[model samples]
Target: MSKKKIKADSTIGLTLKTMVISPIALAYLVYSIFQSQIQSFDSISTSLLLIDSGIVTALQLLLFTKSAKKVSLTMLGILQYISPTISLIGGVFLYHEVLTNAHFIAFVFIWCALAVYTISSITKWRQEQMKNEINMEA
Candidate 1:
């Protein structure tokens, strides 16, 4: 399909998704306001926070859905690490927060696990593709 058509479809999908979800989200927000500790914030601050969070969430959802449509599921899963990786970098470099040995070890382990998982997934996909090709030939 043409890139223009894909872009239009993705935009429409995002709008529809937002429209369908907004009511449920608003209901939950109202429930939280009554049931949770929302009164701690004065009206102005609470309203600003609500608006900021809503905008951030909507942007994240839009970006995530658009990228997800364009990328393989495996790549999308791997991309989930970007936020944490950014946090890690920011803590170490920008904020000058100390990365303790345990945290460093944990970070290493997580990346190692992700690498192993990615390799295994790619191998499995390749094998499946080979099998499909063989079947097609037969």
Candidate 2:
């Protein structure tokens, strides 16, 4: 159960799922269109927007699957915070959104937790390195 093999297996599973699901999804969309449930794509912009979103979603899934193979589940869970953190920053700065006091407190807590987790991981890695060095010397 090498990492590469695991990644490949997961990728194959994803592809299989996509194969099984995409046709049904496409059929539903087509049915909706035939039933006049899908109203108007009055402009090229709307079609392009849908295409752009589909591309983004596909890329995100591909990258997530690839990275999941190389990282510990704990680290993966920690890294998942990045998307929400970025969204929060975008909302605050780009969209001029305000954070409540509770939101600020939560952000601080998240940062502190990340710091502690990082320090612990580094310390464990250092101890492992030291043991390897001693074993080599012996």
- In order, candidate lDDTs are 0.82, 0.84
Query: Model 1, range 1-138, lDDT digits (tens) per residue?
Result: 533236565667778878998899889878887887567456888778878997998788777667677786667778889899999999999999999999999999999999999899989989999999999999
lDDT of 2 by residue, 7-116 (tens): 35566766886899999999998998898897645578898898799888877787777778888877787888998999999999999999999999999999899989
Give candidate 2's root-mean-square deviation (CA, Å).
3.5
For candidate 2, list the clashing residue pairs, or say none.
none
lDDT of 1: 0.82
TM-score of each: 0.57, 0.72
Best by lDDT: 2
Task: Give per-residue lDDT, candidate 1, residue 42.
Answer: 69
For residue 105, what is the lDDT in candidate 2?
100
Task: Report the lDDT of model 2 for residue 126.
Answer: 100
lDDT for predicted candidate 2 compared with the true structure: 0.84
* Shift of residue 4 alpha carbon in model 2, Å: 8.9
